[model samples]
Target: MAARILIVDDDPIQRRLLEEAVKRFGHEAVTADGGEAGLATLAAARGDFQLMILDLVMPDLDGMAVLERLAKAGETLPVIVQTSRGSIDTVVGAMRAGAFDFIVKPVNHERLAVSIQNALKISALEGEIRRARRPAQSGLGFRDIITKSPEMARVLRLGERAATSGIPILIEGESGVGKELVARAIQGASDRRTKPFVTVNCGAIPENLVQSTLFGHEKGAFTGAVDRHTGKFQEAHTGTLFLDEVGELPLDVQVQLLRAIQEGEIEPVGARRSQKVDFRLISATNRRLLDMVKEGRFREDLYYRLNVYPIFVPPLRDRREDIPLLVEHFVSRFAAEEGKRRITGIRPDAVAMLSAFNWPGNIRQLENAVFRAVILCDGGELTVDEFPQIAAQTGHVSAIRRVEGNDAPPPAEPVIIESTLPPVATEDGLIGVAVSSGAGNDPAPFGFLRSLADDGHVRALVAIEEEMIRLAIDHYGGRMAEVARRLGIGRSTLYRKLKEYGLADGDDDDAGVAAE
Candidate 1:
């Protein structure tokens, strides 16, 4: 599909050049002379454009001001900043103002096109999330599964095949890996797509009421059972029933569930006879049902019934390649949900840190981390400082130390030097040996910094500095003067750091650094 792009630049020559480059990619291009004109054009044809190109320096409202205004107005169109040469400060400033990505001026057509393509991909992903949040009255489909990993793709293939048979299926994965999501995907893809997809968390319900919850209850079935209540199975008749955390179901409940599945009928807690009910069963669990059966915690017959068609979802750590796409998805999702357009995307270094860590809690953990970052992120690309847990989990001490202006010493060595005759020669030779050994053993912090410092990643360094200042301030009980005294810096310098880091004065919660 052809993408639509909007170019906002006061320079006529630059605008023409951008327009030509966008057309070369077979996309429709719209141009505006300045920020005001761009806003007016965007407001008029908001749905027409997929990406925006913004110039940092413009007449009658600069790029930062325009971006702030757009965010205030709740316009979330993707914007790539066009910065002048040697304008690192402006580039960082623009990024902090919510620019999607920035292109240094004296523009390279090849690089610009690549940047635009990436921004368009982000825009498309945001559009998908918006569609997912829409009312399900129209219909849900496999498109609800927002995954790009091979593991998920294979699971999806199996799910699609199993959805047609109407046989019982079990989804196995770590907690928060979206087991219910897979079940929903199956229901959406199956012949029962339009029918009700009832969900019940076996782990969340009390043991005493487990059977009643699944098999319905008659009036006066129990002390609190004042009226007749239909169970999840009955409600899901002619549709699909999703039993989450099925391993948590007690043995007695297991026998009843097995009977209901085999007979296609349910006997209410206080009823004399069974009522016929037909529905497909989709069970999910984070624990191993087979192991439970071996341990006598779960019944063997029930395990077999639920294991007829099992789907395993790998954790987020096993599929590191999908981290970037998932981060983009969550960023856009939370940004829209929170009604804040100040956040755009995560910094590449932060993405690297996320990819490196092991997500013990799986996709749910990652989602929570992203949401926490979004909430604490002060209107800019997310950075490593926004997620200190990632750095801690990944053992990125060297990276953190470098950010704190600490130089790591070389590895320890035991040596005894014997001086022969010339004192000057011996001293000089020892100094040379020490210098060479230090250089050989220790990695350069600047090199590590420079490697991740691509496309204005120096902004991440700024973020780290700001986080340090915030920590210092919090450590001193929001006392800026005390923090400045402890760091051996001036009070004004601390205040400037606070503003530079996008931290408000007197906000003392260290929760900002804790990646929820």
Candidate 2:
């Protein structure tokens, strides 16, 4: 989670302060004496730095000029600009030049940290969506991959090298790990970028038609062969051929597949002769082909041929660093598509919870979760409330029954409520309570609210008032007057509910909340 950041400033004091702040926030910081040095370090680092904190005012090469140069060079690195002048003109200019954010000089630690996080999140979104500018399937390059984890970095490096030739690549990973995307990237980066790129899911086709599907069938070659069909091999002539779930190929078809790889020729069913095809073969399988080979399901020779330049893409959980990036990108994309453009980002806690779950279905599952969260989001940002199912999986206490159409914001902790079960009268009208099990299941039992303060004495009136005030504040969206009125108390009584319950500044008219 600690990203490397470059701090650029002409003044040593400012640089030192920023560097300390960055380090204090648990990130690695590299200092540059000025703008020129920052750019030089960036050039040499070769994507080593995730973000830059640059002072806008410098001698020869100012922050604005640095940003312009970066944009001209097609760099998407995020920059946070700083200046003593808090003028709107400077901020607008910096933002126009692609600065992720602008902060006034002598930065506040909290503000600087927030800016750094937002810039990183935006940088990640840029990295993932940059591929959209190109063709979705065929024209994507290694840079289009959204990954900050070293595991994926290694995979991309291997893939880039394999893309330089017509090497037979056997991509191996769990399902939905983006194996097909890696294959397309390799093909796009290869010499056959403009040629046909055909994909075949070997497992999805019928067992009887697998051969005909891959090698084509002549007109009336079989019962359902009504027309002369061009196979995937022929379709990918002079380009790349992707075989997904190759481990599921029929045993007999494996022999024909081996021959095709060995001689680049495919014999269509009912055809006396074989036709040669020029295509780069890239096969992907979630299973271990070696195990299949041992079980006599997969042909060993065919496996060896296809596995020449193997690239293994790690699953989403293995590369946890990519989750936040992918989630942010998906939220942005789905929000626009759903016409909820106000939903810009997800809360850090939501991202943290997502990062903790081991995605059994890999990237595909994570993407779907984000898409659903975006659609369910009712506010400007996504929170845990938007991901109730996932939160329950993480053992979060959201199991309490929800009232339809109730839009009260989620409490910091489980909001204790009276149970719907047959009530046992305790005192006055207060009934026995039940605690949520955090599993979205019925709670067995928990005692009623204790009247004593653990000293064999009844609780004080102020203590009971404090608890009621806190609960009212959370339930009523922090409206102080409404909280006091609901509790049948004066405004003075509500003010006493402040500091202990996290409202540090309680002197304002509505406790800093404006009238809605």
Candidate 3:
């Protein structure tokens, strides 16, 4: 492959000779008059050139000074130092300053070609090493993830395979899509399962403290360094270091991070010596690192280093089929945690409602919904009444279908059940009953209640009082005096009925109503 070469020599004649010689050897060359000009060229090109040729002696900004600038700027382009005859000391110094190789004046074309070839080969090998190391394709540990969607299944399969590999892993997904969960599963499945799993939220740390937080700092490193602190890298030694929101790391911190990954060591703030750390890297980011790199907000080299094993966790909407399973799992888990033995499972109508929502917050949002529903559940099953936010959007009543088997389909139609509805005043100023499910031709009140309708036994008085009380309170915004006036009963009677129906506290009242 043709490589771009930069030649920096003070002698115009020597520079022209070197450029012509490299061009003939199947390489492109750009020349600079002096060391300062060479650096200026590199800075303007910004890593465009692959290799550089530098003459040791220069009037200004000597070769050693140029090498120092490259080191300070974190430029890794290979360099071939040129030295004059009897300048053995300068040649040795050039090598110590990080030159790829050295050549004497009146350079041999064959030796120059050989040196270039060897440098290119080493660079190629490093590139291959970056792309070669990958995790096994299977045997993932995903105990906490409950999913039935094919999309999620594929994600888990890939994650499992990546878990066994020792290379760095990059997980990408929207917030709440379980990126950290995937990271944990990968770590759990890895050989270092018994080792420490240290997690750091890169975006959460204060910008000024990010470096000290990741690389640690000795006492008196800065204003807040009253005590010595170990960094995440050292803490996760021989283990896994999960950097969530890694894309949010500042550019300066990205440089430090690249050095740590490339050299396997970190120099703590205010510490003279660097410490070696052995840790597996697993980074997660919601933002696209490629986009950031293009925008110059993220380092391209660091992006490549962290993206050895890429895994993407699909969002909840993309895998809607898994919602039911997730709901059931969360219900069971939260039920035991909340010590609610009667909360067996969610109703089919409630599940349908839940499955219909496009959970923008993903799995975490779903888990919170299930937990909240479990707390509100009064019967053995979680019904639509428990999930007001979902129910409000759906605008439907609970059909009360028992959870049949583990994977029963949702009910096709909602079952109408009469509940206590508020009373509305008639034209003649008398109380009237407004049927919640619309009036039916059966003419029998409380007909939908199987318990009350059995054997033609309609508990008319009890049902009327319940219905009247409910409607009155709802109509008058839960004002007991007005509810009593509308129902033609006293406030004492309204309170008595409310207590009898377990609505005394008015906690179960609809949010649209105001309680006095």
Candidate 4:
């Protein structure tokens, strides 16, 4: 297939010559004067070029720097590295750093043509594989959750089971793993689908207003209580109340929450008496709430009340087989949403690249990447360039180059791997958590910490803890309760840490609204 190729060279003569050669090889060629210009060109017209021919040594931002930047940015266009300084070491280094193909200067036309052909062929093959794996459309109801991976399939089964139980359910997973989606799916599948499905981010509410926001308040109860406010529990009467980040609720609020759940009644702030309210409660957090109980941060009674029906959603990296299906789903959805008729599918190579990435941001991140790709797509296909994060991690450029040439370095140790799966659930519906020896594919215990230490930029435990909490908050969609739970701390401690770190102070002033 004829592709648009980019050539990055400091020497004008070399650039022009390579351009002519690429054109002759049945591809359109774009040229960049140096490494900086090449990167600039790529950023400006991302997704326009399918492959790049890059010169290793440039005056500014040498090929290595460009490669590093691309890796950091997660750009994935296959790159062929050309250098006059061609020694075995240089070529090996380039390949290791993500150069697709290494070619010596004084280029040979036949060799260049052959390399291009090989890279394109590999690219095409990957595209075909992805197309083969992609489901035509996602399933409905709980299956709308979308996955072929056994891990997520199990979670969905539990979710489906939880839907009809008519009991409070707790969904647990890292932020962005779709706790909200799971909650919605449960509500949708339940008998109460006709009724309201209310959601409240517990952490987003101010400490002073947690009780009022959840259980309503009389007019003039507090300084900003301009009107009689109905709480989420009242709004979700006879339906579902999804409390996201339940770990963020203050201790006083937790006390009231337990009472409300136990008695099916809530006394609004400044109300004369408790009013009965009926709603199916569904709570989610990314935290280890059991640990919170041990630490005395969470109310044991409230934790038990909410943990009656627990569903743990698996992270994306743990279910990579589902990625292609999700990519297709998102691509089609975003294409239609953006009115982009040309954006029908992603390149197979792109799918492979995406599947290999450990998506720390999970499905939401993938959705965002696909949305961006669809908007940026210049053609019918979403190519490697469209998904920079995947590209960078997969080292697509280097791998492609190695395939295109015979003279390349042997493979190095893998820098990234899929995230480890959570402990399997026992027949009793409780997850079995235990440490395993790294005898097989299992990673060493605390491997990530070892990696951090090995990097030599050792962080203070407090700093690490702060960052962990921050990440958990982000992953759990700003649900502080979930963050605290995941961090094995109490909501109170989480709040204290947040204040100490100068992080979010649980003071989202306008977030006090009780509306879904």
Candidate 5:
């Protein structure tokens, strides 16, 4: 991969030289004027940039300060600091602040290239190690999924049911919504728990190789086929085969897939006959297969075979309740992995800030955010400083109470209070709060939300939906874009509701909504 490197320096000449040197090494370079600008660039990139080359001495936001900020926020991006001969002692400080390597000024192009190579090598190795360790987690059924939301609870219930039967499961969700996690949970909890679990990313493989990847190929099956290869299907025999992004399969491959599902056999390339193989099928996708079928891009027979037991995983924005639990879980895991033992908890404002924004990338994005934050974190508790990109977005922090250990989650039931206003709390050893939604000061009893009416009956769906929309609008200060995002709906959908319920257009965001 061509690494995107951020070159931070005060001197324009130095920046230009470094950029040229990076291009010569076949890597992309992004230059920042100073340390402050460097930090801003990092925030804007959202983990796209892989490495940094920092100038040790700068008038504005010195290199040391940049490293400190990066270390505190759990930023794992490798840093290679460049300094002058006179500033040798400061190089040690930079190292302690998370600099991957250091080089002297009047840059030796060879030395800079070697340092860059080592930094990229180590970064790639770290990522590889993380992936190697994932299997260690899939063995633990349902425990690996961190969630407190009812939306997720429903998913889990469906997964548990699927585990008991031999039905083919089709898990639908936006990318990064943990569809694979749910698949693993089903396999782990099933009768085939000890059997091999083979996974294939249909989207990642080249079209020509998809057939050979899914079905074993005989030696000399095609050019570059020097050795017999056991494809994913044979490897998954008598166990489970998880085909991720299954919708990406070519039309021809879909026919074979449908055959395999119906007959429990797969034909490898250059094979004389199809071989019988028994395996549980669990497929996942971020696309609408029905629509694809209607568009004649997918085989209708294959779609029905896969959609027998459909389970929809809600996106992160729709399940804000899960963010705190997931944050705490990731903190505990990444802190140990990264050796940041001092970091134990996250600030309530930080949790609130995380909860307030709609994560378009879902859990994967949030996980990356927290990983970066943990590396950037400077203290025991993570703060907004650690999440600069998310903090830059329109969000607010609701004051909350932290419990013992600053690590335990608060009670689920909201404690009612006679306070002037309600406090929304998102906590895990962080903030706690009591909400008040009562009328006429009769010591109104309220939970995080109201489920029952004054007449002791369940509330109507329309009333609940309207209330949720209004609360989202109020919480986001009428920034309709934000309100729509946090509510997990489109701007157009939010506009329709505002008109339907006669809600005020906060900030007159209607112009933007209308354009949408």
Candidate 6:
């Protein structure tokens, strides 16, 4: 079906241009001259349009204000902002206000079409997500799990099939890849959902008590058995039993577990009576069970029995495309839970840094980072400074440095430092020096310091030391002792450095301004 779009611009020529562009793609277009008229048309038509092409500078109502009003009214139609020539600030401001994308004046038809196509794609994906979340009566539908990636979707499908078949399932993935969430999703969608879903962490319990935990024990069974207790299997009868970290089960205990799973009965400790229990089983482990089996660490027969339906959850790094969505979800959840509404979103640079990192701990680590960032963030957007680890690990100095308003110049090109410094020395001494003037000629003894300062690489106190001393002197009315104390420098040394930097007697502020 052809998509319908609304074009809202004050200029007749621009509106006609956009209308022609929309028609060239075989789509329908509606045009409005200003924001008020566009909003009225939108309300009267009740979101009949699939997208909106809005002008950033309309006379009656601006594009940003219209967008804010639309968001307030719970309307989420994709919007593409149209900016005049050389209006980058307006374009960026529109984007920050939730515009899908922007196009400069004298728009290229090809680029405009591509942006429209992308907007339509985003709209379609959101529609699919909404449809996927619709509840099903049988509890065996796709709504039980939340995922967009093809790999996770395939796993959910396999899990759904296995849940109906009453076969044991083994989920394999890295730790914190949401293995237990998948297990619970399966249980929730199965016929046994109404029954108790018992879970046991094999690695968390002591080795001696694992058997008793899984198969129960009679009164006076072991040294501390006070009364007869039901095992996980018995407790989960007619339901599902999820064994997490199944690879951690000891060899001797594996034998008993294998027998209990094969047969529908368990022989409790110190009890002559054997009890029958019926339950579906689901197990998850991060270890390679096949390797363990080959090494005689895990029983092969037990592996086969549990491997009836194996599902693997891909790590977060493998599916980086989902990071943006996940960030939005987590930010909203955390903000609501913490009762803080000041934080609106994350800075673009921080998101880039987050996407670039190799998430060794998967989604769990990402969640923790977001939670920490949200807690430390004062208000507004979260920046790279909020996440020190991302900056440290990735060596990305700053995600973004905004040039406020139109007067500010565009950002400078990023400096790529390729150090020729040799392997760092163990002792506190300069290991290598910059060669200058001749082959391996270290001109100045402090050449490394000059290089670092010139390249704007100095950080923290050293970067601020010279400036702080000058500022303190000026603030303290030029008392040398007070300036030294405030700067945490000896009075004599302060005077020496001041003279060295040509700042003696307050000659020049530039002399004491360190590169940052």
lDDT against the true structure, each candidate: 0.74, 0.78, 0.75, 0.74, 0.78, 0.73
What CA root-mean-square deviation does each model show from the true structure?
19.2, 14.2, 28.1, 25.0, 21.2, 16.3
Candidate 5 residue runs with Cα over 4 Å from true position: 1-138, 395-516
lDDT of 6 by residue, 347-399 (tens): 76577767777789988998898998889889777877677665445544321
User: Which prediction has more favorable TM-score, 2 or 5?
Assistant: 2
Query: 4 or 5: which has the higher lDDT?
Result: 5
Q: Please, what are the lDDT tens digits per residue for candidate 2 over residues 1-516?
A: 357899999999999999899998877899999888999999998777889998999997998899999999988888999999998888889999999888896688999988887776666556546556565555777876778899998999999999998888999999999999898889889999888889999889999889888999999898988899999999999989999999999989999999999998999998889999999999999999999999988888888998898888998989988987778668767775677867767876677778877899999998898888888888988987777666545533332222212244444554345455764543222233344321222221233222334232445776655555555665577777787788788766556557655554655645354652
Better candidate number, 3 or 5, judged by TM-score: 5
Per-residue accuracy of model 5 over 59-139 as CA lDDT, tens digit each: 998888999999898888999998885465676777888999988889999999889977865675574465456566545
Best by TM-score: 2
TM-score for all models, in order of appearance: 0.59, 0.69, 0.51, 0.52, 0.53, 0.55
Clashing pairs in 3: 137-161, 138-161, 140-160, 421-471, 422-471, 423-471, 423-472
Candidate 6 TM-score to native: 0.55
Q: Candidate 1's residue-wise lDDT over 230-275, tens digit each?
A: 9988999998899999999988888989998999988999999999
Query: lDDT by residue for model 3 over 1-516, one digit each (tens)?
Result: 356799999999999999999998767899999988999998887455779999888998888999998989878788998878537777788888989999988899899998987775555444334323322222225744666678877888887888778888899999999998788778878898778888999999999999989999999988979999999999999989999999999999999999999999999999999999999999999999999999999999999999988888889989887887678667766776687856656776577777777899999999998888899888888976677665433323322221111123334442233447554433322232322332221221222221122122333677655655655554566676677777787766666677787766665343323444
lDDT, residue 272, candidate 1: 90
Where is model 2 more than 4 Å wrong at Cα? 1-7, 12-31, 44-53, 78-129, 136-138, 400-516
lDDT of 2 at 323: 87
- Native-referenced Cα lDDT, model 1: 0.74
TM-score-best of 2 and 6 = 2
| Candidates ranked, most accurate by lDDT first | 5, 2, 3, 1, 4, 6
Candidate 1 stretches with Cα past 4 Å from truth are: 1-129, 397-516
